[model samples]
Target: MPTALDRPTERPADARGRVAELRAVRAQAVAGPSARATEAQHAKGKLTARERIELLVDPGSFHEVEQLRRHRATGFGLEAKRPYTDGVITGWGMVEGRTVFVYAHDFRIFGALRKAYGGAYIVMESQSIGADLTYAWPTNETAVMGAEGAANVTFRRQIANAEDPEAARAHMVKEYKSELMHPYYAAERGLVDDVIDPAGTREVLIKSLAMLRTKHADLPPRKHGNQPQ
Candidate 1:
């Protein structure tokens, strides 16, 4: 099963020259888009995807798979932009002694308890999407939607009726975050397990993985059904 760090299952056919091809691709995968991209992430106080993975797993334990896969999307502006790895890192690594398959990408975070805004985008990779264990950083935005949209839509009538519409909107936006979207609201209510520091994420994950290693389950077989593409 795919975990947070891996989703693609396609692997290239084995052939004589595959080792050389993979070595070249692996070198590219480790570098990311460019040195400038690394600078940009550092500018925003964020780690690159691979760096985060390395931090979470045992040293020298991650064995990345499917690094040569590409997307098949044909239309829109996507046709000509088929980059390798599909902009995600998918593979497995040891967490303590457990072998965990993982993937990394820009995930939809779980909601920040009460969101008061526009149509909420269900994050495709959040706990709401059935993640077994979820974690958040102290600085994560952790909202279902932006505070501005929440205030504008939820308090539309109040803003329009107020003598100072802009002031009303501003107050409502602040109220929305403070009253409904408090940073620790999710952890308080069990929506998320905890709020953690970025530097401590690896240690926390190691502990959590150890705790979960004893849990097991079996899914009942289900009838196949046709689903829309």
Candidate 2:
């Protein structure tokens, strides 16, 4: 999907051209760089984000959204290498005849049964955040940000003052991930409810959704809550 993002920003001249553009981007987003890469995922016993979504929603029911969005982080030689969907495939579809939205960020999330968390991790609905139930795979990591970013923010002085800054940074990043970012770490502390196998995701979701199907939340009756700050 133009990881370098070289596509023309200009809109197509006609509806047909626009439709063609849409199809082209969808193909690129779904198929990725090539078929071989998809096969590599299978070889490693993993499913791509798209495939994982397909595993949950009813057949032919899933519809993707924002398949053309790209990361805006620049200046790591990455500005020219940012791919569309930004490694995330977000959308909605019918799950057991119920409308469900999904925000799949590569190997990280599947809403109620997924992984990881950032500042706005509520977008993926953690149990302590908004979800009724949460499940995670065994290989997930959790932190407000990647370990590198978190370490830099949390251990700024230690890293800067170390005898060997690079080694200190690396060791700290590793420690942060293992200690504070393990998947079960969140579950143990009640941030996450449980950890489930990926293969059983559909069943767990089906049961959980059924239980929460009639659950409803109502805002407290109040006036003038949006007072001047």
Q: Which digits, one per residue and each the tens of the lDDT, describe model 2 over residues 176-219?
A: 98898877887788777787888988888888899998999995
What's the residue-level lDDT of 184 in candidate 1?
82
Name the best candidate (by lDDT): 2
Which residue runs of candidate 1 sit more than 4 Å off their true CA positions?
A: 1-26, 43-45, 66-83, 106-132, 164-167, 223-229
Lowest lDDT block of 10, candidate 2: 107-116
Q: Could you give candidate 1's per-residue lDDT for residues 160-191 as a string of tens digits?
A: 99999999999999987786575487678666
Model 2: residues with Cα > 4 Å off, grouped in runs: 1-18, 71-73, 107-123, 144-175, 221-229
| Per-residue lDDT of 98 in model 1 | 79
TM-scores of all predicted structures: 0.66, 0.73
Which window of ten consecutive residues has the lowest lDDT sum in model 1?
Answer: 106-115
Whole-model Cα lDDT per candidate? 0.66, 0.75
Q: List the residue pairs that clash in candidate 1.
A: 4-103, 5-102, 5-103, 5-104, 6-102, 6-103, 116-150, 117-150
